[model samples]
Target chain A: MALEMLSPALILLLAAVLIGLLKGHARTAVVLVAPLLTLWAVWQIPDGVQGTVKFLSYYIEPVEGSPLRRLFATVFAIMVFVGGLYAYRVARWYELAAAFAYAAGAVGVCFAGDLITLFLYWELMALFSTIVVWCGGTPAARAAGIRYAIMHLLGGVVLKVGIEGVVVGTGSIQIQPMLATDFSTWMILIGILINAAAPPVSAWLADAYPESSSTGSVFLSAFTTKTAVLALILLFPGEPVLVGVGLFMVMYGIIYALLENDIRRILAYSIVNQVGFMVCAVGIGTQMALNGAAAHAFAHIIYKALLFMSAGVVIYRTGKSKCTELGGLFRTMPLTTVCGIVGALAISSFPLTSGFTTKSMISQAAVDENLVWVYMLLTAASAGVFLHAGIKFPWFVFFQRDSGLRPKDAPWNMGLSMILFAGLCILLGVFPELLYPLLPYPVDYVPYTAGKVLFYLQLLLFSGLAFFVLLPLMKRTETISLDTDWLWRRAAPALIGLIERLLGSLGELVARGRVRVQRFSQRIAVRYLGQPHTADREERGVFARSWPIGTTALWIAGLLSAYVLLYYL
Target chain B: MANQDEPLHWLVRPATIRKLWIGLSIVLAAVVLAQTVVYIKGYFGVDAWFGFGAVYGFVCCMLMVLVAKLLGLVLKRPQDYYDDPDKDTGHGQDAGQKMSGTEERGNGA
Candidate 1:
């Protein structure tokens, strides 16, 4: 008997539906088993487009395979499994459903063969991820979810316009490498960049992700931006503008993270920083750089999830998200503390960690290309990464002065997820051979040369030194740092209020004009038609008085006689 | 909650941490010294300078911290700056109270 095999996305989506319908343990079983099944399905798909159909005039390739696609899909499936484990016990039933839907969207995007298929999955993510944010169920979460939805919906519209433009301009809808030369491609780039948390509009990431439920945030940390990186790698590689854009994001992330007081917010800003490295690598567009970008994204999702899972544990146990309110957690939550540090070190690209294995290739690419200034700036940004995220996160959240809050370690499942990812971080770092082969291109680079290790160690350690030396200055405050979101969040509303007030005054002026016109007409009616009521005639003023017909005739005759006399003269 | 007299975990004690910091700094300095005996390869001209990574890392970090501090003057606002005044009680509420609220909303975890 022949059987139809569903795409991995459909498998997860179906599981989400089943989970949403059931309660208690059945839902959990579906939640846990669904991702494993999806992973198996992901591995089963062959090397080319398998699921193709004609929709309207276009051929839709929903199941496509390549090393890059498989690489991203593999990590995504792992994320679902791990993220599901972290979230299973704590997350609401609906949140689990939404989260699975979100994951399915991301996996779908990874396997999409054309822009149309990509856009479909892209929007599915935009929608469900917002629901995941809303699952926080706090007033702040509700507001953040609305803002998140608006930003992504706008991005969706832009992307749709771009796709339509491309389709109309050239009669193809296939996903292929593109340049940002024409308006359509530029729109497409901007659309993807928004999801990637690119500048001026990057505020949405920090504003939303931190507000999600702890478990939701764990899922939130993985998918959306990394998928955007995948999209960029697929299209617009070697676009020179991305180099500048990526650098801006790197420094911006560091500065903002340093300024942040909320521990989760710090992590959120660091996401921008890490993704910046990937974006920059894609801009480099060399085979090694592309490999670096893909490898980094793969590595990044694991470690970043590990970090968020740790933070989630803290928030779960102590119910505080701000660094000022955290600290001394290491005393009670030793496992979480260690896991978080591992994640932090990996994020900092520490030697013998996943980051070192993946992130250095981009810098090496910069060197190979001999882009002097870009190389220097990227090197410095690496140190900044170590400074802001590497030391700052662990120190403030785990080891700062005792806040008298002693939270217990994470629950077993959450701890298991952390350990799995932490082990992966170290494993991938120590054995880059495993990850390198999965990369899109051939691997010729050696990550652990003696000289390279020494250089990185020196950079990381001194950055550590600077952190302590300037420790007195890194005090936490009860403040929020404003960003470009303020343009839409505050300024747009303020402008609307200003316009409303201006219109109010205009309405008053119109009312006053109507009153004057009413009075003038009343005067004209009395003067021309006379006051018909004799009883009120005595009360009438000069303008409202009746005029005699003879006086009017005599005035008209005098004006006519003057005109005739002047003409004769 | 003030357990000042309670013996801390040995790894986290103030004295132990201080010693640890000193040990780490010494190790870092030793690595810096090793750079002299074994010169690290550099792709760019500036990277070839002895102790370049250490000096650049430190200076860049210092600049980043200082610049961030300067930005604080303009960028920082009260924690409840964006909150609805009637809804949010700001950061002054005790952690216990806020935590319960978060938990009640099913969002603390």
Candidate 2:
């Protein structure tokens, strides 16, 4: 009976196919309705694994339902709806179709009941997401997509290996709570961390995301890393390593984003930063931390997507994405400016926004657990977040010196999408109870105490002050900062080039040696064989020498007598 | 959108900007001053000091910016650093498509 119920992820996948083939209004109708239908389907599934298929001596559970799964799936469905609204008119058909398929993979991951199903959906996300990246139609986007693919493929391999190890070691593919204590588990954790945009491998995100078309990045921001956070929540909660890794990602995002100039890249790095909070919370692994992780992931999807949508509208209108190339845009695009600021504020965890309600729980977990170090650093990061995202984003893009460019505000569809998500950001922030029940664990936290609100305001406002005081130092230059991705994007190719040169020289040396050997052998042949008719030399040889005939006759006679005597003996 | 005929948007007027800054400073000062009255349940000893949030927030923001600047000294590069003309391989599926002379889209220098 449950199998008869349509899986929401399948609905989206089917819609992706229809989007690819259909034309005109028919396609738009599917694009708009699919996500809502998926949302309904997500709610329809009952708790626990409801659908199973047997394969290779194991039953794969393809569908499962829980508050956590539903929470992520609901937000994902909402993101698809808004993203479709924003991009349906602008994004290429292939991109839209691919993005939908990619999203379906994400939802699929959310419901995946076992490691096999998870890995399959993971690869699906990887494949279609690459198509989405290439849809940017620029060489950099194309190349970045490849690098992204390589990184994910590597991650997939690690994950698959971990899954196989688990299946063989335990003889089951069921998703279960596990620690990163063993090699297999560590692989799974690392694989998921890669998608979470965890450090060292995190560069692929910023490298590829900002290169995508404006609408594409909005979709890109929502699914991949958040799914990894979900996986970490499922598999590696309470793993202490993530605390350090997450903190590093937190600081890494801020510093890099602070140094960044591209509007989208700044947001891109901040994705790593935002996901860092969730990962850190998951590492704390208390019920509160888990709730914080899930809730933050949910809230983050809206505000981050809203931020990207705002940036997309700006780019769509102005054909510019760099802060250096853009300034004083609020003069022309009031709606876009306001939405950008709201998204920025939400991201900075300003009071009465989604971020403030959700992100504080992570620090609260640290405080409860007596992770004094984590709490301290996270607070510092909170201030830094305000500096880089909250103030810097809006300050440069909207209110800095005028650039003398007047662009129209977002089109009707884009504006509608921004308003939708911006409204959600505030609603969730103002009333977090709407989100709390959806979390995997029971809720026992209040985000808006008086002291808490005042503390955050003081922290955030002073950071704003620091921003202005250091305004000169924070100038947006037309530059790109290197990331670990440089190892493959730049250093790997350069390394290959160096090795090629070395190999070429080695071949050249061997060729010279061969030529010298040939010349030496040719001399030996000429000396012994009287030039062999190929040498093209004068015929003055040892046997061909003058007076050689008389000497040859005497020697022949003497040798004949000696040969006869020796033969007789 | 502001009216195009206006010489300057009212928000950007020098006088408006000065007033806004003054107002912003007052608000900042008041928020910090409110901390002295409001009992903040500081998590640690050092954080319980009056104006701790303001001082720490300002100090941390300054440190982030300065550190970012220092990193930029080594990490920042001309945007075109990665746009190698010789990238003849590793662009999966598009290995040989013409570089398409499309506008660079600010992806590189």
Candidate 3:
């Protein structure tokens, strides 16, 4: 296949390969330019399957275009560009390279016209994001990266199995929306849910992301779960099971994040929480709902990356990550503080932020569908989100009881990246028109109606009040909450050890019994085969002694007489 | 580290914090009161009641915190929980089942 027609993802992929070889300005040039070129390529693809090619026996569409595809790809490319801006100065070369490769996979997934192509790109992301986690350059990162890789690879295998099943069953590789009603489709949904950080398997996100390098986490945050959401939108739209899964994730995130101490882990849990919204929207499956999912994904990437960037700067400066270890940073780092607050507000969907414009659409979808339970739960989750992430995060990390930490503001590049995303957050909020048209479907709902604004305002503001009133209860402890990862990291290994011990003891018992039986058999043999009267100390047979022949003769005579007497009787 | 006696950053200053709290409370109250003029159009009946957003938001956060606190009892572990794992594992940590004869065995056997 020609490289040019391969996909826009190739540009970034090729740049990723080249980045390791280049140095200084040349490397910087590639990092900065590649994503933009990809962006251009993304916009150039027109709607529908742009081209089709045969792979072995199956026809595969490597490049396809739709508003949804373009929208997701555009944000991904933008993320790489901005992420490069944020990390180029501070991050290691390998990290930057791995991040680019990981992003290339996400972009590839976006434009993939068939499940085969999507699965290939999905594995590519799984491979490189693991490397990004390892680039954290700590023991924790090493272990977490292994775990992250294992989970994604497992998820990848599940996905591949599902896709194979579907292709075999349907005799096609085309991407089409279907419900998870059968085995293959269920496997496909489950595989996607794992990547989406659904409950039970969701701990991997909170486990791995925080353990990655500051910059690595930013890139890690954007791709994996969001891409899973996209795949869900494409493959399993309107699957009702996702709504409950999403609700669980939403509540799970708030609770875990509220109990968390590490700054990045909090954000990571919230990633699951926010993706929950998109997953639920996909379950809703109406055009407006899908649009909500898409738009929310886009907005989430910006604000989340912005939040991570701010946190990254703080970690970089002070070399601390726990909420308890950080505070009063705003005293010196005004820019990071403001940027973080912007992200915080945006995440909370405050009246004029990107989150406000985007996330509310999901609730609107529920309202339109007359899903009263879903709507109410989503509204409550909105308030819950504001409590944990919007207020709790910034409050503890930037403004709470001073930790006597006075770190400088973010370096210029990091600061610039923050400013860029922070600006986008407000820009999209003020003029959601900037994003709405890019959505997969028409956006009929208005975000800024007075009543809606007042409602959200009250919800978020009173939640902020709840945060303060319950401030004592929100104590930051140096404790980690157990997650499903613990099942493997601790429980599985311990269970294996326990089984081994039991087997070892059982083996010892069997061996002892065998010895006892052997001794008893030996005694019986001695009693029957040996002459006990030969000597007091000798329990051995007398056949080997000098009188052996006489003893044998007497025994033979005694046996003959006994046989004759028995015959007579 | 800055001295404890020094004036706190204005943002965290007690007076500033107190005033900010009051101001934010007023804003919260104002939003709830705005419901009188604007229709929230709740899909659920209970959601349309007076100050539903405010009350619900506060209650949800409180309940969430309470739930988390309760869960913390069972789920919370030291940050180093997985780091060392355990030294004994399943070997000698258990008592009594250890074979007395096994310990007595000579190196030759």
Candidate 4:
């Protein structure tokens, strides 16, 4: 009889407020319960515009339900719960609060029924995620946090402009699927893609995420980009531009990650690569592809968080993140090692892993669409994923030559969270039936055919061979590779300096010309008056004085009359 | 802190590692060979070719590594390449220079 008045998002935001009010074990309990409560709230809302309100001259739907919405919200809720467990022991109380607030924004975005509400929640995520990044409390974190904030704020402004344009152009504020027929729609797509870590600006993900506190990075890995993937699926599915953009991101991520040395940054780049699959699936826009994007986003959040948690434990124990400095931790940190490998295999789309079940659907969609190039590229990228992340991560960090370091396994809560997600990774892969019905579309596609399994095994294993064979070539260096951020980080400042120097010389030349003119005018005034002007300051010539009011008026009139006369002639 | 001279876990010993690598190589060769027996069909004719997955994966990975190597020539810089000159102190552009105190702190090592 009662219409569900409260959204899960509000529950999370309220929980954040409550968390800020409490401390210690009490705050942990609040963190743990809040997400479960939000999940319950998420399930209670039924399909079709659950809550609406009238504002100004327009009506806004704040909560809308569909299979897609529930799927995204469910994963987000799960992320918060697991992420909370991982962070509850290690994070400062404020970081946990900010993370809850960030998750709340992502949850709100999933339920948003209109463009205005979506924009508001989008910016909410930008604000809180920046706070989470700054929670890293290092110089690099501080700088990276500032850059992260600026990038997201710029993206928010673009999205806001698009939303306003769409409202003005269509006379409606509803957030339904639309084509890129106009500037407004394209703006919205570009805005979403930027957050998706689509190229050129994709540098922010790798730059900022690795700098966050280990626990903070776990939360950061889940929310911002995945929310963007959700937005793309909801708002711009079947937009063709995303296909090309996604492929670029896939290869770019692989190459950059291949060149990386820091442990977290490798995972950071791989996140972009993995999201590329979802973005491409959204571009394919078939029911299957949309399902794949949604399903993959769900799988990605779990596996990626698992990976970050494992790495976080390493950094927590050893105080080192670079592969060069970390090796053979499997000796002492066996549980963390196995968990990290599980995450790595999942990410690589190894057979019988969550990735194998979900990611193949995107490639299947690509083939069904007769996108030969896309299908081939996705297959090749799968191999590269294994080479760069699948083998590279576990090999260097856990099982390579000994670096004489013995760090402890993750503490109880962290290990418990990792084990839970690791179990889900396999569970989802083995029983994908559990996931398929939860997709936005009806269930039809199957993932585990014998041929498909064999093909994937061959692809992944050979990539593994390439890794060990090329191990010497892939040695970690004590150097950083340049990315597109170099344009602003180094080149832009140098360009600005050059411009300043040129302007300085020009100003000097103009000053000399003015002095000469002043002397010329002084000689003319002395000649006309037959007086020595040096004797009195008041006798300074017209050019030396600020221009007289009448003279300036006469010059302006003369120029105007000349232009007018020329026109008449 | 534990001394580096302490004995390591038996599984991680250097001799064990060499054996593990040999075992892994044999297992991988078997996996590549299994592709022939299972006869996995591919979407395209080119993909269906013998050892296609292995060849594709190996060649693509090799290209990826080599291209990354080429890129490193231009892209790689001393770890402190971006740090302020004043802050970097002794670690001035030279590879041989010992890192300054500030550089060590910045690396968080």
Highest lDDT: give the candidate number.
Answer: 1
Residue A367 CA error for candidate 2 (Å)?
Answer: 1.2
**Model 2, A425: alpha-carbon shift in Å?**
0.4
- In the range B9-96, model 1's lDDT, one tens digit per residue, is 6877778888998899799988798887776998877897889989999999999999999999999986666654544532233233
Better of 1 and 2 by TM-score: 2
Off by over 4 Å in 2: A1-6, A527-569, B1-6, B85-109
Q: TM-score of each model's B chain? A: 0.69, 0.72, 0.69, 0.67
Descending-DockQ candidate ranking:
1, 2, 4, 3
Please report, as a value between 0 and 1, the fraction of native contacts recovered by candidate 1.
0.63
- Pairs that collide, model 3: none
lDDT of 4 at A70: 93
User: Which candidate gets the maximum TM-score versus the true structure?
Assistant: 2
Name the runs in model 1 displaced over 4 angstroms: A1-5, A526-569, B1-5, B12-14, B37-39, B84-109
Could you give the fnat of all candidates in order? 0.63, 0.65, 0.63, 0.59
Clashing pairs in 1: none
List model 3 lDDT by residue over A1-569, tens digit each. 65435789999999998899999999999999999999999998889886678879998899888999999999999999999999998899999999999999999999999999999999999999999999988767777889899999999999889999999999989999999989999989999999999989999999889878889999999999999999999998899999899888999999999889889999999999999999999999899999999999999999999999988999899877877667767889999999999999999999999999999999999988999889988989999999889988888888776676678789999999999999999999999999998998877988998878888888888898898888888877767899888889888988999999999999999999999999998777676556556554455553433456787799899999999999999
Candidate 4 residue B61 Cα shift, in angstroms, is 0.8
- Ranking by TM-score, best first? 2, 1, 3, 4
